[model samples]
Target: MLIVSQALIPHQDGVTLHPDLFLWDKQLADRKQSWFHAADRTPAEWYASLQGSDVTALLARQIEVMPAATSQCWSVTPYHGQLMRDSIRVYPEGLFPWCSEDAAWLCSTLNPLLAEEGMTLLHSGAALLLSCRDALDAKPLSFAAISGKMLPNRHHEGADGGRLNRLMAEIQMMLHQQQPESRRQRGEVDVSGIWLSNPVAWPQVIIEKKIAVATRNPHLSAIVDGQNATVVISEAERLDQLVKGNVELPKRIVLTGEGYAVLLNRSLLPTFGKPSWSPKRVKSEVELISKLSGWIA
Candidate 1:
């Protein structure tokens, strides 16, 4: 099984705060094995690597293959954030104890407001950006997606080129105003806003292996879905149980997040260390893809 875990390895300064991950890293090092850094740093980029196709072409195919009942699909992820002066500081989902009830309530209340703008919201925080009356024949005006684990600091760097900036700002205001008093009294961080990433259609990929993907990330799950792989929506911390279950093991298993790759057959234990490719060494996605393709082959 091949496991891809979310940011399990933190930067040097974060080691103290992430003692558990730090210990896991040490265990991998003791075995003289470490995860190889892929061409992309974000989970989205890492997932893109698994697809053996051009991203633009893949998205186009998604539109072609989309069910007639839905006009378009955009990955919308909820996040908790704080307002620091004029800038907003978004926190990872792990920081909050969000339940399914919270997700459903937010979707139910917000979907109607969004529908007026030609979008239908789903329970998984996805929005169907509709363009026509006939769901089966509608042409999508725009396609967009976002990673749930992104930091507000990076989004401020104009990653989305200000496309969803105004939309997010509006959503932030709405969340703040509609935030429940009960939640505030409980000291939970406000479900402040959301971040939008990759605006593309889904791709159609052929599945050849019995692949099992263990992750709670919707973006990762969407990618794996294209490959027709079975998904186990569990947090990274609970991955050991999935890996050691009695069920038949898949040919490959991927854990997406802080980005680790473990060959379960070769390494009986989870290992961590410096990624094989450095930012300085691999400057482009093409180079990273080529390197990873060769290594995995």
Candidate 2:
């Protein structure tokens, strides 16, 4: 099995992702396509599907898969605050570039509030992780899920979603109350909010001992594999290049994007007889995207 993260755009419209996205690579793209009908998810969800419970619970369980590994229990995201009228917006870490001092101070101020709800915030090596007195039933959205999106609406999700949503509100209020708006006006980065993962268990990941890993996710490399699969983790812009980099296909190649993943199952070995290009039907981008967009939804 091969897992390629960001294999497609989370919000792809009619346009082809890359020039050679599908038409140029029939061996992989047209092998046996299987698209998912579920809602979109963050790229990290695709990676965490590779690890066992121990490894997962051990990363809030996985942060856009996090800055570094830690034994700490609860995972948190240092949201780059972009306050809007009705809701807040979250930016990627690149815009904020969290500092140790900022993290420490934020923790110092927020820990007390967090303690009231049986939670503690700690600065764990360039990222933030929350520690809970009990197992948390609800977790915030994966940081990657909302990197440049509006904050998720207050939805009743998971077992303890009510409490989780309340906590998010309190944190946002705390930041704004602590002069974050002023700080923003002065052009300074502020950790005014945080996000956590829903802890998704990908029903899609195939457990194979003998496997080769290729990824941009920092945490998945710790996985101990034996050799039958080749997992490729790629950024949005580089999916085509990564696949092309390895012309040899595994028994199957799972190309996953946000909300959905497609399976391309075929023989692992390179074709021995007729070339894949013998009778290629290169459909116009319009035809392909029209059919694909339906299933992707």
Candidate 3:
């Protein structure tokens, strides 16, 4: 079963690092204590690094002894009984061709940790908040788990090139056109610009994505459009039916096994509240990390 865990990024001095791209920048990695290299590190060494126990210790605190009660203690699903819905932001830097080797390694490392507790890491799409909680605030805040990096194995050539570029150009255009004030009133816009640009992009497909979530609870939506880039959930009507019907939707959803991680924010939760959706911004840092532990297990 998949569970949600949320962590806050340091946004000091009005400078907040985009969570998705935070690990992509070598400069930033060099200065911080990030597990961006976990995938490449041997499990023995990786587990050794968490010895002192701060973050990992916290993770340990959240663990539980299974019914069989063997040597392996595991974490209970973090979001299992939690009430609040999460809103995640997936940065472009986490896209293919942009993620670094270490980023991929990190993902490989973390996957097993999740699996130990009976969960799998998915190459899913997510979204970010179109407007910061504080309009005057320059720092980025995430309501969901931001995918820090992309899978380095994916390729960007061939027919996919056309769709990728179109989506990219469209995102750039929307970022340029949609201002904070405008988006506030309009709420959010679809991230169709990126999908339309990808080479092998085909937006009509829906492969286990969070098409909609209830707005009454505050959530974002994810969907596949005519283009393949994965659209952001900006409207709540799609989710409205779901809410009326009552359902449990993933906080972060993907259009395909190899698709973008689109996030749904409160503004569009209403549509997701019904049952469905897909939104935007400027230059943002992106990162991608894999779960190596899963591979080992």
Q: In order, what lDDT does every prediction score?
A: 0.42, 0.51, 0.23
Q: Write the per-residue lDDT of candidate 3 for residues 1-297, one digit (tens) a residue.
A: 111111123234322333433232232222212112111211111222223221112222222321222222211100101112452233322121211232233234344443443332221122111101111111111112222322112324545344333433444454344333433455433221121110111112222321111221111111123233221222112223222223433333211111222222223212212221111231111232222122212
Off by over 4 Å in 3: 5-155, 180-182, 185-297
Global lDDT of model 3: 0.23
Best by TM-score: 1
Q: Where is model 1 more than 4 Å wrong at Cα?
A: 2-18, 31-48, 53-72, 96-99, 124-163, 180-188, 202-210, 218-297
Ranking by TM-score: 1, 2, 3
Q: Quote the RMSD, in angstroms, for model 1.
A: 7.8
- Evaluated at residue 169, the lDDT of candidate 3 is 47
| Candidate whose lDDT is highest | 2
Per-model C-alpha RMSD? 7.8, 10.1, 22.7
Tens digit per residue, CA lDDT, model 2, 1-297: 455544444333421232335533556544645455323333334443443232334343323442232223554666766779987787643244444555567788898898777666765344456665556567555565566578788754679888878888888888777743444666787667777554433222333323355643333433332243345554444445445644665565555444445556674455444322111232343343344333323
Ranking under lDDT, best-scoring first?
2, 1, 3
Model 1 lDDT at residue 74: 48
Candidate 1 has an lDDT of 0.42
